[model samples]
Target: MTRLHRRQALRLIAGATGATLATPAIIRAQTPSELKIGGMLPLSGPAAIEGHQVLKGLEFAVKEANAAGGALDREIVLMVEDDEANTTRGVIAVRKLIETDKVPFIVGTYASAVVIATMQITKEYGVPLLSGGSTSVAATDANEPGNPWFFRSWPSSVDQGLDTANAITGRFGAKTVAIIHDSGSYGYSLGDQVEQVVKDNGGEILSRDTYNAGEQDFTTLLTRIRSEKPDAVYIGGWAGDGAMIVRQATEVGLRTQFVGSGSMVSDDFIELAGPASEGFAVATLYEPSTPNVYGAEFGKRFEAEVGQAAGTLNSLGFDSTSIGIEAVRRTGGTDSKAVRDMIATGLADFPIVQGPEGATAAFDAKGSVDFPNFIAVIKDGVRTLA
Candidate 1:
């Protein structure tokens, strides 16, 4: 079954408590009592695959929390809206989630552009937005010295590019590189960062290319890049596009090592690229072989529910949602400001599953976390730590 279908089939329904009337007349009235959280995600567009994994991660965190008697002594319900990765649609979803659904906070959107667009809505309503995806440094910069309503649990593009560039130039000893990126905010930001890093380290950039997301043909670009004879090529796009690029590169006999952002470290990339994915390196925050206690448990749950091992995106969702729930539990209520403050100040030692060994979730003054990014290479169709 597809992950979307599996999501529908494996829905874990939470029971709600009913309010009882307390009066001398002894008239008992019942009302459903639950805490509602919002998710604004791209469930039906180019970014859907990324969004789906994040949703599963959000579900995993909620499932665990509810099993342990959820936050504020209430069962948590996740209400989601499909933004389709469009800024206008994302804003509408954010407003509806805040005004109509009355969700205490929102989580889980993959595209950096969408997340950046909806930030204003969440801020206007004083609702906290815990982002599990979207790594563009621009997203965090808007939050500046910490915007009260936004908290990012993902590593920034700057961090990912720095490490990946270091891996290409320092480790693999590639002195000349070609860069390709999509036009989206996340992709563009990553490509820019990687280019800067490569130049800073005294590497020569042969060429730079940009394409829209979901573009089919890369033959022309690959042929052009091959002519430049760069030592390595860095892809700053999503898995689907990355897979196609590598596959076409092989078809054109453009023999160069492939390195990319965290988005390339996925089953989708490997399965789509087939033999071409071999030797593909990516910089990412999570490695399944090295999981903390929470990560191990999350991995088992993800595999059981999603029928696949938890990857970097899933880990991102888990940590982001887990932190929000923990904040609400500590706040003793769903007051948005209280929850935001608690997350900003009280989560210094919050344990999470995504970063280095024994890693804990903590936000900097810019409302961004400092997660360690490491290089992983695909060998024999398996993503193994390098």
Candidate 2:
């Protein structure tokens, strides 16, 4: 329950900035005995399930790094806070980490809205943020001219939306589609992109609708969508909202092909939707079937640690943390500016853990990693790569 006041945070940032400018030699000369990375996740809200999985992935990575004599011979520690999927809470969490815990780098924030809100604070504090699950293009774009402190370890929502549109039109031969999304930042941004991609590919958008998060009753939205009678329905939300939509769509007798964002590939959605989840397609960046020794070993270790198979976001958390640790190791110190520069410049060609697409993790100029998005189908309550 630690909170950082605005004045206190600003004062800390001012002090850190002054120190960086006044004594560059002293900043470089000081080598920290241990490395502490901060994390802000929705560990107590509707997104808690996914958030906990992400936490496990981060913890597993830290455990592995510590087992191997730690990063730069300094033990790595993770300081986490529960964002609760709220913007205000997210900002407070980031502030507490930056000013209170004094971590040089942070990783986490599953929801795009949370990441967007927290990144501003990290930028002000001159700390690097390694995002694990926030896929909004705007998250990194907000950094503007030169995003030296923010890095996204996942594919952009724009790419995922385009991939979903291509799969629907190309594989399913759908000429018309309807779009439904939650009212959150991630859903709205991704839904808008998906709608445009569908239109660009010679597909007509029959209808577009939105619902609020934590809404259990989707009958009203489903009824309107049923009236349009599009060939397919695209869900631009997380697994929980996606599950309710699928189940309600079935109840309303709207038998259209259902496709979803990467968030729908989780076991929670599959189990919650039951038979309704069958034949559902999801565009995702992580494929557990990645053919690489590193991927296989990571998957095995993740399952052994969490007692369940790893999902896309789990792998994302692992990659984001691993890349951050590599940046810290390359810098040979815990200085935030040095780590940020190394990540921005040296991260592109450096080899880290393999992503779901079997590609080595690399960051672009905008701090986004390039990875292929694949469409997966849920068959008999299991997600299979399509």
Candidate 3:
């Protein structure tokens, strides 16, 4: 398809809006010579490390796809925007990608709220969004067939919450639980799911608290949790905050077992928490020890190119990009509706990096990946499947 040029698209948009163009678009519309895909990520602020990892993974996939003759007989171009994990920024970034860069599909936005906020813009533009990081069930609820533009690669918060809650009650024998989470959609929903599971399993809720995203000092909260004498503390937030909380909990002598989900499964948490990360159990999809054949090869290439071991975020990014490439290849073009249909109803048992012996990623009716969840424990500073 021949899309509008930058100047032409700007003129069309300006004419359509019946308003003066405030500023020129940062990136011009995709040229007819190359196929373009958009990515919105938290490349700054607290989630920079994760965003970089996802970017690296996407880069690797693009390079590989290009080497394999590219998708739709054109080089796959990935244009990214730094959402900074903020909703307004995410909306702006996605809008720029669609209206300015004219990307037919987008692939990211780590924070759940950012994904939720950007969905409307993608839908309005008739673009598809494939996310690897955002895991809130609310996002899944929004991606039904009635609005089939958003598809997620990662398991939902509900799945991870259930796994972590079961680990708390079954593995740790925790009768009383305390919860700490950020005020974001991901954290809040995770906390609710964990709390409900713990209650369903006949556990007591000692305390539930919410904190800002990058709050460094968890001393007061840890002290209160210690006094409450809970058997386990479930933390739902990013890796940096999770590390700080566990470290502070240990310092304040809160001896209960520490459990977490999503970002807690990251090495950044362990490296930051140091010895405090010992015995920390987290729900995760990726484990370095057990990768499928394709994943193992991808990990080796990823380590060589990125100069580090690949994590869950990287794997998720790769998987999401793989599906996008496949969709474009199967459809023979980057038409948004065609790609969305290829993913939602046409895809079947597409291989991915996380799962059983031969793990594959496929979307359910609600656009959630049909995959199993597992609990991994940080034993002796290594994340091993439990």
Candidate 4:
């Protein structure tokens, strides 16, 4: 096999068992126990793209971990639930994941609002919720020691705003920009970040536009933005709505270049925005298919296995499982705390998630990984690195 294919095949294994090398050098054999991890994600709804990815990743991780004798030598039973992304339905889904499934270690709720609401319930039950999605600052910060079981894997929108703004400033050398938000927490947070980033980088803002969620119309907003003709327009919203805005913006002949977050580059967004989505730029975590030494292998394997493309944030859910299972083999346990502690402390040199050049995946103090951020622009109806 070619080196790339070999790497792809290896990554496709998603297990850390049967082979001595794949097993951690430190972890010895231990008695097996039965433990379950809950996966709360949007199986249906506007945000289902992310939900499906999280579910796949969780399942892949659990399978590999189990093959490795489970985390802490306990079987990692998975309990899956759909949050639906609606306020009430999200709350219900998380509650069911915890109470009904009796899963102490639950991962879920991709939307910030859902995470916020569900965190309250998880906190009440003393269950550890390592969220696979939702990067709103609220996920990590309630400023209370009351609930320590919450953690997030994605970079906070606050930090992303700064990163994005800096990137924009460096690229454009423009002095002014406009902010557009979808009036949702995720969109607002992204706009807020971009606005701050623009200001920080010596760029002035002309206006900040806000719209309601599920809005398929953007002629007014585009007209206003087009009239002002800011150097660039920064929009932050999920793929579905963002796609609509992009399509409308193009139809209205809005001349400004668009910059947005990763949520604007999903299956739903791609399908909805169609050709209008092209040429828009975004900042995101992973890019699987982008040509890179490390990620190229995994990227190819991902496509071969799933029969679809993976993005720069480059996981359709299996990456999480791969990392978790490897951690289990290394720590020799399935205990939530044990797996968590080992991942936090011993995962420095680990290579579970791959990124482009010089990109690493070490978890920071907040128990989040060092994900890469790439700027991708739409070209001919596809997101391509700019």
Model 3 ranges with Cα > 4 A deviation: 1-33
Superposed on all Cα atoms, the candidates' RMSDs to the truth, in angstroms, are 9.6, 7.9, 8.5, 9.8
| TM-score for all models, in order of appearance | 0.89, 0.88, 0.89, 0.80
lDDT of 2 by residue, 1-90 (tens): 011121111001223454454422212222366777888888988787678777877888898889988887778889899998888888
Model 3, position 343: C-alpha lDDT score: 81
Question: Clashes in model 3: which pairs?
Answer: none
Instruction: Kindly indicate the candidate among 1 and 4 with the higher lDDT.
Output: 1
Which lDDT values do the candidates have, in the order given? 0.78, 0.77, 0.78, 0.64
lDDT of 2: 0.77
Error of 4 at 33 (Å): 10
Candidate that beats the other on lDDT, 2 or 3, i.e. the better one: 3
Q: Model 4 over residues 94-202: C-alpha lDDT tens digits?
A: 6666555655456766787887777756655545566666778866775253324455544577766766777677775657798888777888888877887678678
Residues 69-147, candidate 3: write the lDDT tens digits. Answer: 9886778899899999887788778877887777767888788888888886676567778884888888878865545
**Cα-based lDDT at residue 154, candidate 2:** 57
The alpha-carbon deviation from the true structure for residue 303 of candidate 4, after best TM-score superposition, in angstroms, is 0.9
lDDT: worst 10-residue window of model 2: 2-11
